[model samples]
Target: MAEALDQARAGRDAAGTALVAETRAVVAAAGAMSARFRSGGRLLAFGRNGGAADAAHVAVEFTHPVIVGKRALPALSLGEDPSTLPILGRPRDIVLGIRPAPDDLAVAREHGMLTVALTMGRRRPEADHVLPALSEDPLIAREIHVTMYHLLWELVHLFLEGETEA
Candidate 1:
């Protein structure tokens, strides 16, 4: 039990340190994407089997504000609705392809939506920004998803707090 606890703490520490360094860069990138979306841009998120949850979580974080002190940002998850996807097949709208394609990423970039891809399979689209995650082990993948989102939420909260104060 003691060993397990220690290992967990170590993991948390590592994640935290890496996040502290990475958060500013991510926030800047996300903010740029958000700006484009504000000017009639949309968000397109795609993932394979494991990517589905990561895509969904990101969508939720942007669509609905989770941080207690931050405002909600506009975002969409293409994978969540099979029915709607059929109607909105265009790249301008959020579309989740079954597989990755170079064209897909290009379209997403062209349309001004930040492309977020989650995959454990052959690298496809080559998104403008790729957030690599565990492709194997379902449990580990879920943990990664949770940890990544927590970091994102914290960064967003910080940004929002500064904005409101200003």
Candidate 2:
């Protein structure tokens, strides 16, 4: 029990160190992405298996931002709601993969939206831009995913105004 506790504490310490180092980069990328989302465009995030869960968590973070003191940013999840499931069902929506067609990439690029692709392999896409994320080791990736979003949520609050009543 003592050994396990020490290991956990060490892990937490390491995570905190990584977070502090990468906060700026994460903030900048999320800011650009957030701008695209706010400007009449949607951030289409996708991944497989646990990556999908990370994608979903990111989608929820944007759709329902949990910033302590900020306004909610406009975000949409491709697989979150049954209503928009139609969008995904249709071939028109820009889907992420190694070789998403130029036309499909254009669909997203033309809209000035950010295409956030989360994959665990070497299938990079050609889009307006890409934010390469870590997802190889599931354990660490999931932990990073959680930490990344939490920081992002906090950043949202840091940048935007507090929530308001409709």
Output candidate 1 Cα RMSD: 5.6
Q: For model 1, which pairs clash?
A: none
Which pairs, if any, clash in model 2? 71-161
Q: 35-128 in candidate 1: lDDT tens per residue?
A: 4444454445555554566667777876687546566755556663333433443443433332344455565555543554433223445565
How does residue 41 of candidate 2 score in lDDT?
A: 45
Q: lDDT of each model, Cα atoms only?
A: 0.50, 0.48
lDDT of 1 at 122: 30
Per-residue CA lDDT of model 2 for 66-97, tens digit only, reads 54545555444444222233344222232332
On lDDT, the candidate that comes out on top is: 1
Off by over 4 Å in 1: 1-25, 37-40, 80-104, 119-125, 134-138, 160-166
Model 1 lDDT, residue 114, Cα: 52
Query: What overall lDDT, based on C-alpha atoms, would model 1 receive against the true structure?
Result: 0.50
